[model samples]
Target: MYEKLVELQSSTHEEATQQMVADEEDRRRGLEAAKLQLAEMEEKRNVSLLTPFLKVAIVETNSPAFEAGLRSGYQILQFGTVTSTVLASQGPSALMSATAEGVLLPVWVREEDQGEPRKILVVPHRWEGKGLLGCSFDPIRAK
Candidate 1:
């Protein structure tokens, strides 16, 4: 009877160990799936961030905008905190309001040749040109 009891306990322990291993494998697979999903979501968000909202209509020579490497035909993805959503409700004034004198504002832009988006730091201080940026922007119409 003692030997029988020992055998039963050993069998029970083996079964429990196997179940635990299987559960661990399932958990690992679930974690991997969640990671893949999160990566996909991040990729989509990055792509959206690169979408252009406004195009640089003109950039004056020797101006703050030109000094910052802004060029005509470059599409503006984001200017400071101004995005397409803000432009939709607030117009171009939202972008102007985001700028401040002597402050370097980050602007995301894409070239007209469909290149990858790039970031440029622009200061809004007075320049030799008309506007603070010495550049003009035009809204990109949706197709």
Candidate 2:
């Protein structure tokens, strides 16, 4: 009976060791998966001349576009190309002297395809959270 009890204890220890090994393997796989996910997110956040910010104007102050380094009075020659839309303040442009906070402005200005400056409004999906450099810093495609 004593020998049987010892045998049972040995079996339990072996089982525990196997469980520990399995758990460690699971943890390793989970960490690898997390790393892969982070790499994918970084790749997706890349800025390319394809999607997202098609056109970019100059920079401004206290503006989401400005926080994104978008200036004002410049030219959104690229992403603003085709039929993309720019989110500006809408409704009343008044900041104070009103009940509500203010209006949201997102104007959609399109460049005429006719003999113009030949600006390319190419926005890459990768530039999602990237800082907005000057619009003219890119290579303008000649028409």
Each model's backbone clash number: 0, 28
lDDT of each: 0.85, 0.39
Query: Among all windows of ten consecutive residues in candidate 2, which has the lowest summed lDDT?
Result: 92-101
Best by lDDT: 1
Per-candidate Cα RMSD to the true structure, in Å, reads 9.2, 12.6
Q: Compared with the true structure, what per-residue lDDT tens digits does model 1 show for residues 68-101?
A: 9999999988888887878889987897689998
Model 1 clash tally? 0
Query: Model 2, which residues run further than 4 Å from truth?
Result: 48-143
Error of 2 at 51 (Å): 7.0
> Which residue pairs in model 1 clash with each other?
none
* CA shift of 57, model 1, Å: 1.1
Can you write out model 2's per-residue Cα lDDT over 1-143, one digit (the tens) per residue? 99999999999999999999999999999999999999856633432222222334443344345444344333333232222122223322221211122323232322323222322221222224443322222223333
